[model samples]
Target: MRNEIMRCFAVVFTVIMIVSGCSGREETKTAGGGGEEDTKPTYEFRLAETHAPDYPTTLADKHFAELVHERSDGRIKIDVFPSAALGEEAAAIEQVQLGAIDFVRTSAGPLAEFNKDYAVFSLPYLFDSDEHVWNFLLSEHGDQLLDSLESSKMLGLAYYSSGARSFYSSKPLAGLEDLQGQKIRIQQNAVNIDLMDALGASATPMAFGEVYSGLQTGVIDAAENNYPSYYSTGHYEVAPYFLLDGHQRIPEVLVISMTAWEKLSEEDQELIRTAAKDSIAFQREKWAEYEQLAEEEIRDAGVTVTEVADVSAWQKAVQPVLEKHGADYQDLLDAVEALRP
Candidate 1:
C-alpha cells in the first residue's frame, strides 16, 4: 500500500513539471517574436516652419517627416510645427542651435546670420532665373555651403524654392523709381537692409507676422516676398500692387540640429538625408503650381500685378549693394555666374 501511494505522488509531481515547462516555452516564443508595440518609434523629433500649414514648405516639412518615419520602420517620428507655432525663423534657428528644436525650414536669408556663406542667397539679382538658382544649389559650391552649417551646430538637409522675392505696396511699383523713399518691410539681414537702402527705400526689419498690420496701419508702405506668401498672408488685401522684379531668389533651407542628428545611427542619418532630398521634388512642383495660382488669383482679386520687363534698371540700382557684400563672396559669385545660362 505504501509503495503504491509513493508511486502516485511521483507521477503527480512529473505531470506538474511537464505542464510548467510547456507554459514557459510559450512565453519565451511570444517575447522573442515581439508584438505591435515593440515596432513603435523609439525617438520623436520636431521641425519648425513659419509658413502656414497649407504652404509649400510646410507641406514638404510634413512629407519629409512622414518619409523618415516610414523608412525607419517606425523607429523614428518627427512632428512639424507650422505657422510659427514654435517661433519665427530667427527664434527657431536659435532653438535648433541649442537643440530645443530638432529641425527648421526657414529662408536662407535668416541663415546668413549664422553662416556668412548663406548670405550669397541674399544678394539681390544674384540668380538670373529659377533655373539659374537650382543650377547653383545643386552644384558642388552649394553643397559646400550646406555642409558649412556644421560649424553653427546645424545641418543643412535640403533647399526648397521660395521663388523670387519682389516688392509690393499700396502705391504703384510701375518702375524702380517708385520704390524710392518707400518704407519696405524686410527680413532682419544687413544685406537685405542694404539692398533696400540701395534701392532708395527705407528698410524696416520686422517679423513676417507684423507685415499685414504694418501695411494696413501705414506703418510700412511696402513688403517683399514671393507670390504665395503675398496671397497666403492676405498682405495683398492691404498692399494691392505686385511687382515681378524677381530679385533675390532666396531658397528656403531644411536644417537639422547637430545634437539631434548625432543621436541618429548611420543608417538613420542616411535615411533622413535621402528623405530630405526626395521631399524637394515634391516641394518644388507644388511651389511652381502655387506660384502660378497666386499670381492668377491675386490679379483676379483686383491687385495691380506689374512685370518688370526691364529689371536692368532695378538690378543696376542694387550694384552698390552687390559691390559691398559681393567682395566677401567672390568665389561663390563666380560659381553662380558659371552656372548661369
Candidate 2:
C-alpha cells in the first residue's frame, strides 16, 4: 500500500511538471510570435509645418500620417506639428537638415536660402496658372530643382498647393501704379522684395506668421497671399480687399531629412513614396475646394474682390525684378515660359 501511494504521488508530480513546461513554452511563443516581439524596433517620424491646422497642407500631413501608420503596420508613427508648433518655417527646415526633426513643409522662400536654384519658384509671375505649376513640378526641370536639396541633407517627397499669391490691401489696386507708396508685406525673399520695390510698394519682408499682427498694428498697409490664407489668417478682417493679380504661384515642398530617409527600411521607403504621391493628388483637390470656399467667405465678409483690368500691366512693372535674377535662373525661367499656352 505504501509503494502504491508513492507511485501515485510520483505520477501526479510528473503530470504537473509536464503541464507547467507546456504552459511555459506556450507563453514564450505568444511573446515572441511573428514580428511583434516586445523588443522589436519602432521608428518615430516628426513633421513640422507653419500652416494652420485647417489648411490644405496640414490636411495632407494628417493623411500622410495615417497612410504611414497603415503601411508600416504601426511600426512607424508620424507626429505632425502644425502652425509653427515646432518652429517657424526656416527654423523647422534647419532642424530637419540637422536630423533633429524628420520632416518639414516649407515654402520656396526659406528653401531658397539653402538652394539658390529654388529661388526660381519664388520669382514673380513664374507660373501662369495652377495647372502650369503642377505640370512643372512633375516635369524634368522641376524634379531637378527639387532634387538639388540632396546636397542640403533634405529630400523632396512632393509639392503641396501654394495657390497663386495675390495682393490684398485696405485700398484698391486697379493697376501697378496704385501700389505706389503702399506698405506691402512680402515674404523674406529677395525676389519678393525686388518685385514689390519694382511695383512701387514699400516692401517689408516679414514672416508669414507675423503678417496678421503687422497688419492689425498698421505696420503694413497691404499684403500678398492666397485667398485661403487671407481668410484663414483673419487678414481679411483688417485688409478687407482682395486683388486677383495672381503674380506668383509658389508651391510648398514636402521634404524629409536624408538621415530619416536613409533610416527607413526598403519596403517602408516604397510605402512612403506611394503614399506621398497619393497625398499630393488629395491635397490638390482639397486646395481647389478651399480656395473657392474662401473666395465666397471673404466676399460675404464685406471684403471687395477686385479683378485687375490687365495682369500684364502688373507683370510689366515687375519685369525689371525678373531681369535681375534672369541670368542665374534663365534656364528655369525659359522652361516655365515654354509651358505657357
Candidate 3:
C-alpha cells in the first residue's frame, strides 16, 4: 500500500511539472510573437497653410492630410492650419526649421532666400507653358530639387500649383511700357523687387494682407498674382485690370521639418512621401478648375482681362534679373532649362 501511494504521487508530480513547463514556454513565445514590434505607438503632426480653405492649395493640403491618415491606418495624424493661423510663410518656415512646426505650404520666393538654387524657379519665363512646367516638375530633376531641402533642415515633399503670376492693377497694363512709373506691390522678397524694378515699376514691398487696402487707398497702383489668388483675396475689387503677362510661375512647395521627419519610422516616412506625391494629381486638377473659375468670375465682376500678345517684350525686360540670378545658380538654372520637354 505504501509503494502504491508513492507511485501515484510521483506520477502526479511529473504530470504537473510537465504541464507547468509547457505553459511557461507558451507564455514566452506569446510575449515575443516571433520578434514582431509593438504597433500601438501613435504619431501626430501639424501643417500650416497661408491660404483660405476654398483655395486650391489649401484644398490640396487637406487632401494630403486625408491620404496620410488613411494610408497610415490612423497611426499618423496631421492637423492643418490654414490662413496664416500658425503664422505667415516666413514665420511658419522658421517654426518648421526649429521643429516647432511640422509642415508648411509656401512659395518658392521665400524658399529661395534659404537656397539660392531655388531662385531658379523665380526666373521669369523659365517655362514655356503650363505643360512645360509640369514636365519639369514630374521629372527626376524636380525630385532632386525637392530633396535639396535637406540642407535647410526641411524636406520638400511636393509642389502645388500657384499658377503663373501676372500683373493686376487699378490702372491699365496694356503693354510692358504701361508698367513704367507705377508703384507696384510685390511680395517682400529680393527677386520680386528686382523683377519689378527691371520692368520699370517701382517695387513697393507690402504685406499680403495690406494689399487690398493699399490698392483701395492708392498706396500701391498694381500687384501681381495668379487668377485664383487675385480673386480670392478680393484684390480684384480694387485692382480690376488683369494682364496675362505670365511672369514667374513659381511653384508652392509642401515641406516638412527634417526633425519631425526623422522621428518617423522609415516605413512611415515613405508613406508620407507617397501620400504627398499622390496628392499632386488632385491638386493640379483642382488648381486648373479654380483658375478657370476665378478668371470667369473676375471677368464677370467687371475686371478687364487682357491677353498679353507680346510676352517677349516683358521677358526681354527682365533679362537682367535672369542674368544676375542665373550667374548665381547657373547649374540649377541650366538643369531646369534642360527639362524643356
Candidate 4:
C-alpha cells in the first residue's frame, strides 16, 4: 500500500511539471510576439506650405496625407501646415534642407537659389498657357529638373499649380507704359526682379505674407500672383485691379527632405510616389474650379478684372531678361516651346 501511494504521487508531480513547462513556453512566445510588434517603427512626417488650406496645393497635401496613411497601413502619418504656418517660403525650404522639416511646397522662385536650373521656370513668358506648363512638368525634362534637387538633400515629389502670376495694383495697369515708375512687389528672385524692372516697375522683393500690409501702407503700389492668391490673401481689397499680363507662370514644388525620404521603406516609397501622382491630378481639377470662383469673388469685392489686348506688349518689355538668361535656360525654354497643345 505505501509503494502504490508513492507511485501515484510521482505521476501527479510529473504531469504538473510538464503542464507548467508548456505554459512557460507559451508565455515566452507571447512575450516575444509583443516585443516584435513593439519593434515596428512609427514614422511621422510634416508638410508645410505658404498657402491657405483651401488652396489647391493644400487640398492635394491633405490628399497626400490620406494616401500615405492608407498605403502605409497606419505605420506612417503626415501633418500639413499651411499659410506659412511653418515659415516663409525661403525659411521652409531651409528647414527641409536641414531636416528640421519633413516637407515643403514652395514656388520655384525660392528654390532657384538652391538649384540654378530652377531659375528657368521664373523667366517671363516661359510657358504660354496652363496646358504648356502642365505638359512640360509631366515630361522627362521636368523629371530631370526635379531630380536635380537630390544633391541638395531635397527630393522633389511633384509639382503643384501656381497658375499664372500677373499684376494686381491699386491703380490701373493697361500695358507696360502704365507700370512705368510704379513700385511692384515681387518674390526675391533675380529673374522676377529683372522682369519687373524690364516692364518699367521698381521691383521690390517682399514676402507674400507682407503684401497686404505693404499695399495698405503704400510701401508697394502693386503686387502680382495668381487669381486664387489674390482672393485668398484678401489682397484684392487693397489692390483692386487685376491685369492678366501672365508674365510668369511659376509652378510650386512638392518636396521632401531626403533624410526623411530615405528612412521610408521601399514599399513606403512606392506608396508615396503613387499617391503623389494621383494627388497631382486632383489638384489640377481643384485649381480650375477655384480659379473661376476666385475671379468672381474678387470681382464682386469691387476689384477690376482686365484682360490686356496684347500680352505681347508685356512680353516684349521683358524680352531683355530672356536674352540675358536664355542661354543658361535654353533647355527649359526649348522644353516649354516643344510642349504640345
| Candidate topping lDDT | 1
Per-residue accuracy of model 3 over 25-98 as CA lDDT, tens digit each: 11111223678755444567889998898899999999999999898777677888998898888788889988
Preferred candidate (TM-score higher): 1 or 4: 1
Over the stretch 73-140, how does candidate 4's per-residue lDDT look in tens digits? 67677889999999999999999998888889889889988898998988887787988898999999
After TM-score superposition, the amount by which residue 151's alpha carbon in candidate 1 deviates from its true location, in angstroms, is: 0.7
Per residue, candidate 1 scores C-alpha lDDT tens digits across 42-119 of: 577889999999999999999999998898766677889898998999999999999888899999998999998888
RMSD of 4: 14.2
lDDT of 3 at 299: 87
The runs of at least 3 residues in candidate 1 whose Cα sits more than 4 Å from the true structure, single-residue gaps closed, are 1-41
lDDT of 3 at 153: 97
Candidate 3 ranges with C-alpha deviation above 4 Å: 1-37
Candidate 1 structure lDDT: 0.88
- Which whole-number lDDT from 0 to 100 does residue 308 have in model 4? 75
Report the lDDT tens digits of candidate 2 across residue range 32-151: 557665443357678998889989999999998898879767767788889999898888999999978888988877898888888887788777778888778888887787678999
lDDT of 3: 0.85
Q: Rate the local accuracy (lDDT) of all candidates.
A: 0.88, 0.83, 0.85, 0.85
Worst 10 residues of 1 by lDDT: 22-31
lDDT of 4 at 225: 92
